[model samples]
Target chain A: MDGIDKTDRKAINFSEKLERISDLWQPRVIAEMNDYQFKLVRIEGDFVWHDHPETDETFIVLEGVLRIDFRDGAVQIGPGEMFVVPKGVEHKPFAENEVRLLLIEPRGVLNTGHAGGNRTAQNDRWV
Target chain B: MDGIDKTDRKAINFSEKLERISDLWQPRVIAEMNDYQFKLVRIEGDFVWHDHPETDETFIVLEGVLRIDFRDGAVQIGPGEMFVVPKGVEHKPFAENEVRLLLIEPRGVLNTGHAGGNRTAQNDRWV
Candidate 1:
């Protein structure tokens, strides 16, 4: 409980957490384990094509659908499902409707990877 | 997708995954993110008080309820809730009914921690 707040000791409703945020693309830290942080983000439409060069990125769908496009092809992930994009792979994430998901990655890793642009978000911003 | 398999690209239904295993206390790897592994396990009743000395352990309730008893008190986590037990903190987990959840930690971290007893589980056994 060293890094945890009193709110964490209570049940964290995924649906409720999603309802708390309306912004898209920015990830808010919800929990941390070891050097990794669990973040919640709402995404819709198309995001910039990029890749995390230093670490793998995990995407776990809490609601709606997620599609990750690679050079070769694309994969659609649904609720209760998860996908891990390996390091250094150029890929883009897109969602038709609003999607809520949890991303697990090392601290300091950018959401947009090295392709910093307008969509790049500030890291470690908790909700 | 270097560290991923073809099956990983597909949506992984948590309930369907739970239906595949019937064992208690034994965790089965479901997904991997970098050096961490997402494991699922069914637990009920009381478990030995233990602690992980090197890294924090995460408990995300996929179904049912989880109660983690700490030295000071206990916290009951319901479905969709999560708790992080910091390294070196002694604690015990209990459930009145069967509980299904995800345990995210570094690969090779023992479920039983330093208190290796009969409850100690085999690691990296995928479901």
Candidate 2:
């Protein structure tokens, strides 16, 4: 990414990723380089209880409301308000309606942090 | 930059930079980690000719029209249509009205690539 001089960093669209993945709750890699990954995830309702063991992931609400529930309290974010969940913190993210989110995290970030549950999707297929 | 776990990259507002720099035409760094830089620039009217020697900068029009004049042709982008100028291309950017743009480039991106002429500001001061 260091060579991305003003002339070299071309503007790229993230729409192509949206078309690739259909199922909800799974995140697909849209852009990646080295250890970083930019993923697009479509979510609805509440997700399984999980926690990342190694990396902290960022969630940017692209369209709808996102509620991140923590041990202490819950945070609600709209199209813009962003909250950073601490690493290894147990959390659950839910949305009332289908919401598009841009997730930034390191490579190898697992969708189900704590493994299988009723809400966990079967495939982590790249879309 | 790799360590920017989603937890670490807390949602930060770009409004702070918007307040610090009142003068037009100057780009200020609002966020930086390693080589990547997110800059905010407020613009008005037409600007002098300039070019980047190494990097290809990505410009996202946050507010108004941004017309880029190249030797071969011209391109006007509004809102989200992004175009990347190749390395070492001489061009002049102009705006018929006041505009705000988010510039993404590597560190050390100079505002005036071709030195003083008319639109060149006296300083490239960081806000």
Best by DockQ: 1
Tell me the tens digit of each residue's lDDT in model 1 across B1-127: 3544545566667778889989999999987887899998999999999898899998989888999988777788888778888888888999999999988999999988989989999988998
In candidate 2 the C-alpha lDDT for residue A109 amounts to 67
* Cα lDDT listed for each candidate: 0.86, 0.65
DockQ comparisons of all candidates to the true complex: 0.55, 0.14
Q: Which residues of candidate 1, in runs, are more than 4 Å off?
A: A1-8, B1-8
Q: What does the i-RMS of model 1 come to?
A: 3.1
TM-score of chain A of each: 0.91, 0.80
- Model 2 accuracy (lDDT, Cα): 0.65
Alpha-carbon error at B33 in model 2, in Å? Answer: 3.8
Docking class of predicted structure 2: incorrect
For candidate 2, give the DockQ.
Answer: 0.14
Which 10 consecutive positions of candidate 2 chain B have the poorest summed lDDT? B1-10
